[model samples]
Target: MRPVQRPRRSRRVLLSAAAGAAAVTVAVLAPQQAGALATAAVPVAVVDYDSHDATEYAARWVNPYGPLDGVVPQVDPSGAVTLSDVPFKPGTDFSVFDHLKYIGISTQTFTVPKVGTVTFEVDIAASTPGATPGHVVEGVYGPPGAWSLADPDARPYTATVLEGQQAGVVLNMIDFCTGQLFDWFVAGGSAFPLIERLPTSVTGNTSNPGCPGATEVGLDKAYTQIIKNIPLEPGQTHHVAISFSRSAGQSNVAYALDGQVVATVTNVGIPLDQQGNRYAWTGTYPSLGKGEKLADQINSLSIGHGLFSLLDAFPFQYGCSPPTTSPGAGACSPDSAAYSVSLSPAERSFGQGAEGVFSGFRVTTTGR
Candidate 1:
C-alpha cells in the first residue's frame, strides 16, 4: 500500500461496552511446489489475533516463527484497541508505524525476498455500531528498507530526498483496510488510483501519469482493475483478504483483494540520483538482524501516520518551500514536526499492558 498523502479528521462517539470485538485472519501459505500457484503455501511468522484477550491485544504478540518480529498494540482501560467512531487520527510519519510492532521481525533484517507473495485473509467487524470511513483502516507494508542510505545517523528510511543515486529501493504496504472507503476517504478530489502508486520522486512529474495531485488523496496511476464504491459497515463482518506480491527489483507489483485481482503495476520507474545509479532494493536493504530493529515502522499517509519514516530525527527547517497543490517538499512544515513530536515516546514495543493473545494465524513465504 502507498502511504496516504493526506489525512482528514473525523468525529468520534462511544459505541458498545468496550470489550473490543472479535476478528480473525487466515493466512494462506504458498505451495511448496516451485510451479504451484502463487497462493498455495506459506511457512512462517503467521499472526493470529482473533482469540486474543485484552492482555494479548496489549502485549505477548511476538511470533518467533512468523513473519512479524514483534507486535506493539495500543489499548486502553476500556478494553482492546477497538476502532473509535471518531476519525482514526494517525501520527505524523514514523509515529503511525512506531505505534506498531512487527510480529517476527526482531532486527531490521527482513526475511521476505523481493519476489513471491504473502496472502492472508481477515474479518473486520466494526466494534462500534454503524461503522463508517476512518473507523478502522488496515494494510500490509512491504519489507521497508530499515535504514537510510542518504543519512547514516537516521533510523529507518528518513532520506526521502532521493534525487539520484540517493540510496536503495523503497518498499512498504499502504492501507488495504476498506477498498472503496479508502478510495473515497483518501483519494477524494483527485483522479484517484483504483490501486497502485508511483515512487515519491515521480509523484509530481506530469508525464505518463499525466494526472496531477490536483485533489487530496488521489493517485496518478491506475491499474487495470479496482473495487469502487464499497462501504465498510460497522458490526458487520467483511471477509477481507489481500495478497502482496512483487517482482525482482520491484519491476512490477500485483495486489489481489477479496480473491480478486484489484491492481497490477507493470512499470514503476526507478528514481535516480545525480550519479544515475538505479535506486533499487539491493544488498543490506533487509540486513537488520533479529537483534537489530529500526526505531519505527510505517503507516498510511492519508491518515498521517507514516510521515516520520521520511522525516529527520529532529525537525529541521526545510530550506525549500513546497507546492501548495502537491504533497511536495513543503510537507515538512514546522507544524508537522510539532504534531509528530507531540506523539513522542510512541510505542516501539508493548512490553507491559493488559494482555491479549493471537487466536489467528499468519502464512508467510519468502524466496531469499
Candidate 2:
C-alpha cells in the first residue's frame, strides 16, 4: 500500500529462469439498461513477459525502519516469480531500531481513462511457509503527496515519509499447504482488504463527538478495512480482480477474489493535474492524461503490482543500542526493554518462495 524510502542491498541467492510469453483475449459486455438492447463487449488486453522492461522487473529491498537482511526475486521455468531466501550473513545484515522485509516489483503500468470501467486481473498464491506469510498487492495509484494539500511535494503527511496516494486490494495468503499440515491450514484463510489512501489534510484534524479538536499527528494514514477475509493454505493460488467504473450519474469500484465479489466503493476519488485533467498512469510521476477533460469525463484509473513490507511504527526510543531511533521516534521510555534485541520478537518470520504465482496480469477498459 505504501512505498519504502531507503533501499539497502542485502546478500541474496540469484536464481534465474527464462521468461515465457502468453496471451488470452477476453471480451466483457457492459451492463445493459432496463429497456435498452444489448451492449457491445469490451475487448481485454492480456499481458506477457515482454510487456515489462527487464531492468524494471526484479526483486529488491525496501527498509523503512532500519538496516536488515532481505531476499531477491527468482523466476522458475514456468515463469513463476518468487522470493529466494538471502540468509543473514555477518556484515550483510544491518542493525537498526526496527526492520521490515523485502519486495518484488513490476515496473509496467496500465493507463486509466477519465471515464468508463477498467478491470485488472491476476492469479496469486501463498508460496511461503512460516507463522506469518507474505502477501501481494494489486493497486491503482495517484500523484505523489496528492493526499497532503498543504505540501503536495511532501510525501503524503510528511516530507520524511516516502509513501504516496493509492487505493487497491491486498491478499494475505498464510495457509499451511503440506498434506500433513492440512489441518493447520484454514479452508479459506486469506484476508482480502480494500485499502485506500487517507486524506492527510483532514484525518487527524477532524472534530469528533468525544474529542472536539483532535489535531494529533498520525503516521501511515492508510485507510484499510477488511471487506472479505478468506484463509488459504501455503502454496495455494487464487484469482483476483479490481474494477473501477465511472460514468454519467455513476461512480463506484469493486474488488473480487477467487471468483467472488469481496468489496465495492462508491464515489472514489483519484489524482488530477493542475488543469483538472486526470493524471495518466505511467512509470514516471507527474504524468497527465490527454484524453477526456476531468470536468467532461467521469473519473480516472491506474494499476500496479508488487510485494511490499507491512511496516510498523514505534512512538518511543528503544533498541539494542541505547537511544536507537528513527524518524518520528517520539521519546525514550524509562524502561527501554521494548526495543532491546533480546525482547523484540523475530521480525522476519516467513520463508522464501514466490509470495504468489503471479500470472495473467491484464487489463480491460471501456475506453471512456
Candidate 3:
C-alpha cells in the first residue's frame, strides 16, 4: 500500500476537513512555542464498517472473554459496525467487564519512535442512547515487553524498558450511563490518587451500574484521579485525538476534541519508572477504537538497554467481517436472526442499530 500522504496544511488553518461542529487546526505558533509542531496526519482506519478489508483496519484475536460470551463483532455495508450485545442490569456480576458489548480495531498495530510525537485521531459517536455515560470509549492495548523485560519476544510492545508490565489505558466518561452529557477522564502520571470508600448513592457515582463491593472501589480509582473529564458533544460526531509528546523533562498526553485541546494527562504511571522516556503503540489486534495505544515503553535511545521485545503472536484479522462469510447485507443473517455474532438475548436495546460510525481513523508518528 502506498504511504497515505496527508495534504500539506497551513499552520493556523484547519488540518482536516471540517466535520460535525469541529474545525481541527494544525500547530502554528511563534518559533519559541513551536514544540507542538505536528506532522501531517496519517489515515489509518475508516470507521464506517462497510468496506472491512479495504478500510485498512483489522480485528485482534485474544482470550479471556467478558462476562457475556465473547462474540465476534459485525460489519454492515453501510459502513456501520457492532459489538457483542450486552444487557444492562447494573451488576449481576461485580466485575467491570461482565455482560459487556463493544468492539476494537487491531492490525497494523502502530508504534512511535522512542522520541517525538504520535497521535491516534478518530471521529466517534454512539449509536444507542447515543453518547450516554458509561458508554465511554476506551482502549490502547498492551505495553512493550508486556510479559517480561529484556526479552526479544516480538509478540507485544513494551511499556517501559525496565519492568515491561502491560495493560490497556482506559478513559471513564464522567457520570456513568448518562455520560453527564459529556465528560471524560484522561490521566497524567504526575499524581496517584485512589478511590476511597465510595458512597452508595446511585447518582454521580458508578454505583448506579450495580457495581458494589470490591468492584465499586475499583471503579472509583479507575474513573477518578487519573484525569479530568473532557466535555464533548456526545451525540454529534466529533474528531478526537490521543497524543503523546515529551518536552523539557515532561512526558504528557493531550486529549483533543474537535481541534481543541480538551485535557492533558502527564506522568501517568510510576511502576515503569519512565524517567524521561515514555513510549506508546496503537492497535495490535483484538481491541477496539482506532489508534488507541496498543503498546508503549520508555527507555533511553542513547544507551544499549534492550528493555523490551515484541511479536505478532496472535492470528491476524483484517477488520471484522459479516459473521456468515456471506456476500452482502442480505446474505448475512439479520442482527436479530439468531444467537450468532454482534447480538444477544441478554441485551437491552435503546434503539441504536448495529454499531458505531467512526468517520475516520489514523495513527501518525512524528520526530522519528
What would the per-residue lDDT of candidate 2 be over residues 1-368, giving only the tens digit for each residue? 01111221121110000000000101112233211212443333434431232233442212222223344444555444443332222221122222223422233334444334455555555433222323321211112111112333332211111111111112221100100000001112344443333222222224434324333322222222223334544334556666655444444555665555555544332322222433222211221221111222222233334333222222112211232232111222233323211111222222221233354455555443
Candidate 3: clashing residue pairs, number: 39
User: Tens digits of per-residue lDDT for model 3 on 139-209?
Assistant: 11222111222235323222211000011112111212221111122111111111111112223334443
TM-scores for every candidate against the unseen true structure: 0.32, 0.45, 0.39
Off by over 4 Å in 2: 1-69, 85-100, 132-188, 198-222, 248-250, 269-303, 308-354
The lDDT of model 1 is 0.23
**Residue 336's C-alpha lDDT in candidate 3?**
17
Task: Decide which is better by lDDT, 1 or 2.
Answer: 2
Instruction: Score candidate 2 by lDDT.
Output: 0.30
Give the better candidate number (2 or 3) by lDDT.
2
The C-alpha RMSD of each candidate to the native structure, in angstroms, is 18.1, 17.1, 19.7
> How many steric overlaps are in each model, in order?
61, 12, 39
Query: Mind giving the per-residue lDDT tens digits that candidate 1 earns over 153-247?
Result: 33222222111011001112332211111111111111111222322222333332433332211212211122233333322333233334433
What lDDT does the true structure give each of the candidates? Answer: 0.23, 0.30, 0.27
